[model samples]
Target: MSLVSKFATVGGATLISRIFGFGREMLMASALGVGPVADAFNLAFRFPNLFRRLFAEGAFNAAFIPLFARALEEDGEEGAKRFASEIFSTLFSVLVVLTALAMIFMPALVTTIIAPGLAVCVDDPAAGGNALSCAMRFEITVTFSRIMFPYLACMSLMAMVCGILNAYRRFFAAAAAPTLLNFILIGVISYALWIEADKATIGFLMSWGVLVAGIAQLAMVTLAMRLAGFSVALKRPRWTKGLKRLLVLAGPAALIGGITQINLFVGQAIASFKPGAVSILQYADRPYQLPLGMVGVAIGVVLLPELARSLKAGRLAEAQHTQNRSLEFALFLTVPAAVALFIIPEPIIRVIYERGAFDPSATPAVAAVLGIYALGLPAFVMMKVFSPGYFAREDTKSPMIVTLVSAGINIVLSLVLFPILAEQGIAWATTLSGWLNAVLLFLGLWRKGLWEIDGKLVKRSLLVLVSALLMGGALIAMMWELNAWLQPGDAVTTQIAAIAILVAVAMAIYFALTLLTGAADRTMVMRLVKRKRG
Candidate 1:
């Protein structure tokens, strides 16, 4: 299969997952709205989800895949299996202890780490009689956090297995496994809505659904590994050189891998001071995540293994070309997506989330946050593209330092802005910090002579920006034309149809302009589609 073809396999599955996630979020918005229950649920889920991102996406992808590829290359199948078994046993033991401790100290974790602002709610003069309500929300958050903490263990194990699959170029099952979480949650939320469950009941059911989904996701990927003729047997945990090396690499890569999540974690911590802020930021996050997951994630997953294998084989030129093409592909899709989201976030948010208990009054706030996030969309994707250059070479420390600096900037900016702009300030802080991370990663690669901007890549990038801007202009015009049908009080079908027309028009204009201007061409695209893996 071509490299792009491999990317397509993962991207297609992620696209499916994102679509299901949209459904889940839509239902969640209707059921919980931007109320206290919604805040409790989102805050609770973020705690485990943060760790899931760190372990599953960050640590494993950054540290595990390249080593697994090395095991396959040097020690053959038997050695790789032994390595996997050893790592599996050790990881399982650690997760068991971690999950137990986290659950036992759930209340402290909730009040101190997850959201310290919630702890002071009862003491606030502004809270008054609402003090009791705040206390209840605090307890609900703690309960939900405990219920879902075990999910971190399931996801961490699943990530290790998925890393093995990626090393073997088996990407579909791992890419598709996330859809199961959305599927299960969608069903749970649907059932709640059908039976008219109250907010607290809905929150509890959804938290349990997360744990169940994590288990199912692990089983699916594990089954895929077995079907692919690979198995890691349970064994006594042993401290081996390989395990020691993985920890050494993973310690730094974890931060590099989870920089985006870390920034969001910080934002969530601060946003918790105001009711509905956490849920508002989350609602805004879903729309942009579609493109990020489909394009950025697919590139990160596919590019890392490919680059590692190329570098391992001493194909220096091939590795450089892979980096260039990955960046090109990432920008080609995400630039236009960012443009669309920035231009029409209000209409998009309204169509997806404006019904039920989600008040029309909340639309502008969410839209503002979404627009700011859209501005950072390409930066986020670029970080995904550039970080692999370091990781493929087993140089996690450089990116780790860059991530820490960016994170500090995010923290400083969030504190400076949140008091002034509310949630939008958090959005601004995240966006600015993202661009800094992307820039530093790119410069690190270039300074080391690991990557260079070829003329084709440079030319196409500029043209892609132009094409996206042209599409954004057209979208503004169309929005003005369709204003009557896109209103909040308009019929749901009418609003959806209007948004659909806008999206269809935007895609057509963007693709047409890219083709006309040679930002992308049929020959180049066909080569990407048809070229086999080197």
Candidate 2:
């Protein structure tokens, strides 16, 4: 398949997943809002999600995909299967121990690391009733953390299965697997609402829902593996050459991944100090994640294996072509979405989240954060596009070094901004860090001569930016024109209609502008599609 087709395969499934995630978040906002239980739930969920990104998806895919693809090239299916089995065995054993230790030390982890902000005021009797409530929040966070910690192990195993599927070019199963998580969460929340459960009860059920989703995700991916004719059985673990090499690369990649996640952890820790800040950031976060997941994560998944195979075959030109096009494709979709978010954040947030427990008063704060997040959206997606150039060559060290520096930037700025910007400072810090990471990744690729923009890609990128700006301007004008109808107090149907009109008009303007600017061509698209099928 062409890169576009492959991206569509993965991205299309991810779009479905993101849509369901939207539903899940909408329900969560109505149920949890920025309450005490909401804070605890976000904190508890972040603990396992931190480990999941570090050990399961990001680092694991970085180290595993290139190696697995290389093994398939060198030794065929049988060889690849053996390599996968060994890695799976070792990963399963290690995660089991890790999850156990984390669960046992959940309280210490909560107090010392994850949410030190929550613990700070929890013990002061002078702080009165609020202090006691803070203490209860800490206790609740720890309890939920322990319950959800096992998901890290489950998802780690599932990541291995996903690696197997992606190595074999089976993107649907892996990409679609995340939708199961959204399904489970939405169902659980909906059921809770049906029974008119308390907020705390809903919070507990959501953590348990995570564990259940992990299991369902694993089973779904495992079945995909079996159907693809791979029997990934647990064997006695040994340090095979492939396993050793993956571990060597994975150690640094894991740190790199953890560093990326630590940026969020730091922000959350800071946000934890301000009552509802954690949940507010989360509500703002969900909308932007739709594009990030649909474009950024999908491209990252497809690019790694494609680049790895091309480089392995000494097809440097092909690798460069794929890299440039993927970057262009990423920007083409991401830039306008970012522009739209930046331009009309409050309207979007108000439409999506300002209902039920999610008060209308919270919209301005969340919208401000969302706009800041939009500033980094393209950079965030481009990081995914660029990093594959390094991973395809099995050079995880460079990205690790760049990420460490980026992490420093995040921590320093977050500290500087938090006291000044308060909750918004955390969002600003994340945006700055994202841009820094993207720049470093781009520079690294250029210096190594692994990536080149060429004339067409550069033109297309500029075209995307200009087109997005125009669309943003047009949307602004329209929103102003429709102010009476789009006002916050309008009926739900009116709000939905306003958003739909805005999106449809924005998409039309952007795509039409791209065509007019020569950023896209129907002939080229058709040819690419034909070539992919051929």
What is the alpha-carbon lDDT of model 2 when measured against the actual structure?
Answer: 0.87
Query: How well is each residue in 142-165 modelled by candidate 2, as lDDT tens digits?
Result: 989999989888888888889888
- Ten residues in sequence with the least summed lDDT for candidate 2: 123-132
Over 4 Å off in model 2, which ranges? 125-129, 257-260, 526-534
Instruction: Give one digit per residue, the lDDT tens place, for model 1 in 1-534.
Output: 887788899999999999999999999999999988998888888888888888767989999998889999999999999999999999999999999999999989987999877887855837543877888889999999999999999999999999999999999999999999999999999999999999999999999999999999999999999999999988889999999989988988889888888989899899988889999999999998999999988998999999999999999989888889889899999999998998889989998998788998999999999999999999999999998899988999899899999999999999999999999999999999999999999988899888978998999999999999999999999999999998878988999999999999899999999988888856966675575543
Question: How accurate locally, in lDDT, is each candidate?
Answer: 0.92, 0.87
Q: Rate residue 46 of model 2 by lDDT.
A: 87
Q: Cα lDDT of model 1 overall?
A: 0.92
Candidate 1 global TM-score? 0.98
Clashing residue pairs found in predicted model 2:
none
TM-score for predicted model 2 compared with the true structure: 0.97
When summed lDDT is taken over every stretch of 10 residues in candidate 1, the lowest stretch is 525-534
